[model samples]
Target chain A: MTSSTTEPIKITSKEQAEWFLNQYDTFLFDCDGVLWLGTHLLPRTKEILNYLTELGKKLIFVTNNSTKSRLTYTKKFASFGINVTEDQIFTSGYASAVYVRDFLKLQPGKDKIWIFGEAGIGEELATMGFESLGGIDTRLDEPFDATTSPFLQNGLDDDVKCVIAGLDTKVNYHRLAITLQYLRKTESVHFVGTNVDSTFPQKGMILPGAGSMVESIATSSGRRPSYCGKPNANMLNTIISAKNLERSKCCMVGDRLNTDMKFGVEGKLGGTLLVLSGIETEERALEINEAYPRPKYYIDTLGDIFDLTH
Target chain B: MTSSTTEPIKITSKEQAEWFLNQYDTFLFDCDGVLWLGTHLLPRTKEILNYLTELGKKLIFVTNNSTKSRLTYTKKFASFGINVTEDQIFTSGYASAVYVRDFLKLQPGKDKIWIFGEAGIGEELATMGFESLGGIDTRLDEPFDATTSPFLQNGLDDDVKCVIAGLDTKVNYHRLAITLQYLRKTESVHFVGTNVDSTFPQKGMILPGAGSMVESIATSSGRRPSYCGKPNANMLNTIISAKNLERSKCCMVGDRLNTDMKFGVEGKLGGTLLVLSGIETEERALEINEAYPRPKYYIDTLGDIFDLTH
Candidate 1:
């Protein structure tokens, strides 16, 4: 829950929209719902971004999606006719690698990292100069047999220092089996998750997110992962240190209440703006409950910022 | 924690063992850690069962493993030279079917039971004369693509009244995707889990259990399933009603503290006997903690009953 005493202010006038834009020097945007949904860009996304850029507001795209690396996100932005560098993209996959390198401080080559996710997380780890395994390996896709499975019979690598889990679409008994073995191998081996989001809206439906995969491994291993995604203090701190931005000059805009709004509010940023283009509804945002987050401001969409200016 | 105020009593002498046996008319036993570990039976299992039969104590094997049906359990029992009727077995699979049939009371031919588990759950539902889908379906084994997956594109059957989840070693994204869709489709569609044991000791390694699968779906769906296995009131109620047994004259013998001991203690059975032959240790059982269950009685192993008398 956010520590806000007052209800979120709705920006309906041109004056309020201008004041909101002028209030922050840097703006952190959540992708998927705010910038685009699935493949189609949200209404007037390009216009809103151009307006922010023209105002000289530093923009950073922070997404909890751990399925893609920063390079892949750069490609996605290119496909949408938006120009963004890898440095401007902060994905949960990248956050996991940063958390391991900066926070855990595992020795790169000597400490092998095991993954229970797609190639995105592995690619991020590789970018950090760490040797990793168990991501997108066809050998792990084989059917599991309790008695005959090699994962159960053969011991895991002792050099494996950490295990990171995210959205593993190729989730099978074998992958989970080896991951559990590493998690339970020793108390020293670290466990990390990209995010804990239960579900995310994609296309016309809500789909299972990385949280499902992380929770499954956590359950079987009787251990909780150090989540490095949105709302987690580590992610905010990492971005703040890397970008060298002032906390009071940064604002977060997102469509999710728990992850995005909570992330901004808990981090004590300049402000948080909620949009109705994604999972959350206006009614839900207005409710005053300890379990629900209260953003500083609300709008119909990210496009509303520029639209109201006219 | 159990309602008992005192610590568990340890049986050491032949006199104590005989008196403990005389106190109960029936005994409910947990199969995995108590009867056998993998395919190998514990010390003097057959002799102890023979002794119980000679004393005219009704024996029931209650296992939380939903992977095997009653018929499959009968075969496993025969393999161990233990003669037990299908009536004497109460697997979590059978309990799930019982909960759906006797408790939910969904119309047999009209309502469908969607399964996210193995063939055992389907077999149990079939035995109860209910039509079920989505168990051991080879079509579910194919790789998942968000846009191209048939499970995502094709709408689920409206006739689905309930979704039952158990330990599915064949767990994949496609199976979970469909299950999430059904869980979020409508409030009327029920979600049920066979058990919630995080891990089970198997082949000298702790492996993921039904709880892992149940938890993954529960997470993605953002809904909790009504668990029908150990420590759940529904399982004890079903067994009590079906067996026509006296609650004050029955004892539960198990090796795991959470599932087995908690099941017996919370059910308010006459007594519970903890054995060190499985997942629990004497040290863990003896420690006093609010979260830890305290059984009424404990011994080194079930075979101690016959050995002490001799």
Candidate 2:
């Protein structure tokens, strides 16, 4: 059996760490649960930020939760006692919007959206300057009363360019019916989902997250949503491009093994820290580590950053 | 517009009627919304039944909704003024149970199950003599407690002989989480969904149905349930066996184009009747007919059965 040592273990042996540190210039972190869960920042999170800042390490907060815009995350981080700008925050929502706009060659103002999500997701679409027909305030116009709203009805027309899924509590029987209807009409219409998480902690209770909602729509519509989140190639590509960092130079830290650790594995990030303060448990960590793309380090909490650097 | 008299109606003419009558000896009908939606039978449903019985046509009722057993359906149909034996009712639940028993090659009582959905679904497994868990009354055991009961939490488990989806309102957060967890662990586990319906008419209001539940589980589990309903091969197989008839000698008559018409196309049934009484609207029928699987006849209702026979 391996020795049960109290000493904080390095992600790599000293020689390996020195070798990796020598090659890597930038680091990416997953917010929510890693930096903080909701409003509660992880202990010593600020110290890690200061240490990274002093080391001149470029840091980017990559989040799959696209229910909030970068501006909102940036502002929220400030409230959590961390100073960050919008440029440092990368969201799958924004990445997806950009991807759809560029790859599909969609004109910014020309494509119409039938979005089913929160304001943050809507804002990201707007930032790309795309016209959307289904938002929180988008009216239930003529031929689509409350009962006929795509949110309420059976089918949406072929003219709909995209169908986006984010966080929407107001999602009712109608939206689902319409989504399936529209999805059946045009398979070419893009189906985008913010994340695949089934539930998220909200106000002390876990609420049905965007994933369940996205799955519902996908199942009903018989269309798979192009997931734009961690572990997805698109989000990883965005991080690589935006940070100007090589894959081998980056490290991802997070509480969820399936999301954060999977991202690190798929992206070929140099290192990953599996913190136990959020979703995955110690048992889950061990199970995950047995697989490929295992995390480089296992920390009881985010405070282990002090032991690693100091 | 062309004159109606000039068009000569172009309906199911006398020659077409004779062709249909001579072609089929066995008929398989779906119960819900096809023969009767809820407790109310469709118009001329009794007349069609009487006519088929008078002609000595072999008939079997197949339903994907597994909330009730064959016996329950037999009783329900009897109350609706149609006589049916338990042997005449075939359910997806029974098909799934048989599939599990055969695939595992397990002796009758050896296999264990962690079932989700209704009593009918569970009863099918029980009938196969499988030791089952995760029913409504099944105790919340350790490690598989309320927080982890795949059925009440998500849908079903991998250890289960089969994870069946029929109809259940208890589909909530806990069920989803556990179902996903079990699915991730075992790929060999079979997924069975009763139907692919989006919504079912309930208490005069359309309600989220089993299809939506199955879809949610499928999305998270990353496995598609082998559907055992209308248009699927299993129902056709069951119909063939139950009626002791060749596939070429069977005709499916129903109200919806997708379900009824697809059955004819795929099952190679002699004829199909697109009845306007239940699900498919006239406009939808026109669009569906243009698709690969087209209906053989369009009827105002089951009352048109007499017109064909005469």
Candidate 3:
């Protein structure tokens, strides 16, 4: 049942950091739980990044949270004292837009878009040269607010060729109804979702995320959206191409077993590290092994990486 | 979109009835929605039966409703003025017992059971000459009461080998919790459910059925139950063997598309006629062509069978 050759290690001090050096050529770090949660940075996170840079290791910040764009995440990381460029950040939102652009091969100025997400997703679509029709405040001027309105009452015009879902704070019955209507009318309309996470941690409580909205639309439309995020090959391809890293030399590290561990397994990365700081509990790890891929190393914290010998 | 040829037939009442007599050699009828709903028989039901008998067609009553035994259904049919022998009726409950007996090949006196259904399912198991335990009364101590009493709570011991579900008025959280616990501990414990339907018509309102209970146990146990009903080959085999009818000559007539039409399609019967008097609507008939083995004919009502030939 054990899939790894590396023995489990326990960490105590900074001197053991040499053990993890040169283990991986390209390191993919998850943003939300690994480096920082919301506005606060985890302890020693900056020092670890500085150390990784000093060693000339390749680093890419991969995040499934598509609520914010790369620019937003870049600014947030800079605020936390981790200086990173926009090109170094990859969001599920960016992956989804790139997937749609390449898959459809939309002619310039010919593609019409309908989006149900925040500014982050809109920016990604715009960067890919796709026109976005809706955003956070795009529907505020209508007689009834389409953004917050019920699905049955909202008027989603037929011009919308693609319906993209990322994250929306005002996701309600009206938004769902309009989305469903557009989906039904245009059977060929491409349905794409940023991720399939049911909930995300916010202020110590779990809030409904993109997966819930995807479920509603999928059930009504009898169509499963093409998810572009960790565990999905599209996102992994985007990351590999962007980093110019060989699949055999890259490693994905995260706290969630399904997303993070799956990325390593599906992308054929060198290794996967499951940190116990968030999401995947010990009990969940056992159950997830029944279906999902297992991580190469299980550690109490990301700091435990220091205990491993390259 | 149309799959079948609409050969319009303007037939007299006599020719219409004769067309049915000539076309069908073996008539398999579903009990609940077609023949009688609960206690009341539909109009002209008796005449239809008399006419079919006079035409010398072999008849078999098949039902997925495992709430009642063949004897109970036979008795109910007799009260409705359609005389039928116990051998003429077939139930999924009885078929499930047969499946366990022949397929699993359990030794007659050695098997211990945990049942989660009504009297019919228990009686069927007993008739099959298998040792049975755990009926509605055995679990709840009182009929139709879901609340667990002290006396009933003690019966949920660890030794139970099988969990069978049909329809139990006393099905509740306490019984479900115990059953789930047993299922989890003894992963080898066989779990069987009558069907996966959520609601059934009762007193002019849709009442929760065995499907919800089956779903609860499935969610907790993380195992799909072995089903014995229409669309499942086990039930179809039982009916064909009981009546000694060639599978090719028999026609399964019912209202629902998934269950009734599925039997016709799977069994490769003479014809699958979808009567619009029950579960599936006219719009559904159009969509059904998208699935395998579409229905032979779509009629407004079962009574229209009397108008099939010119």
Residue A8, model 1, lDDT = 92
- lDDT by residue for model 2 (B89-186), tens: 88877766666665445455655665567677778777767776654543422223444443545644334655666656544344454555555557
Docking class of 3: incorrect
Q: Count clashing residue pairs in model 3.
A: 5
Compared with the true structure, what per-residue lDDT tens digits does model 2 show for residues A20-96? 44555676788777778776777889987887788778888888777788888888988977899998988877777
Candidate 3 lDDT over A1-310, as tens digits, reads: 3233344343434544454455677789887777766666776678777777777888898988887889888889889878999998999998888887787665436676777777778788887777776556545223233334443344555556788886665543334445655676667888988887755665443444566556545655656788998878889998888778987777787888778878887788887777777777755554534446767665666645533322
User: What i-RMS does every model get?
Assistant: 1.2, 5.3, 11.4
DockQ of all predictions against the true structure, Cα-based: 0.77, 0.16, 0.03
For model 1, residues B1-310, the per-residue Cα lDDT tens digits are 3646788899999999999999999999998778888888999899999999999999999999998999999999999999999999998989999999888998888899989999889999998789998878888888766677665566778899999999999999888888898899998999999999888777787889899989999999889999999989888998999999998899999997788888988898988999998878888888776764888899989999889987
User: What's model 3's overall lDDT?
Assistant: 0.68
Candidate 1 docking classification:
medium
Give RMSD to native, each candidate: 2.1, 8.8, 10.7
Q: Model 2: how far is B32 from its true place, Å? A: 4.8
The sequence of per-residue lDDT tens digits that candidate 1 reaches over residues A1-310 is 3557898999999999999988999999999889998899998999999889998989999999888999999999999999999999998989999999999999888898999998889888888899998888787888876666665566678899999999988899899988998999998999999999988777787878899989999999989999999989888998999999999999999998889999998899989999999888889888886764788999989998888996
| Residue B270, candidate 2: C-alpha displacement in angstroms | 6.2
lDDT of 3 at A217: 57
Please tell me which predicted candidate would have the highest TM-score against the true structure: 1
Model number with the top DockQ: 1
lDDT of 3 at B143: 26
Worst 10 residues of 3 chain B by lDDT: B1-10
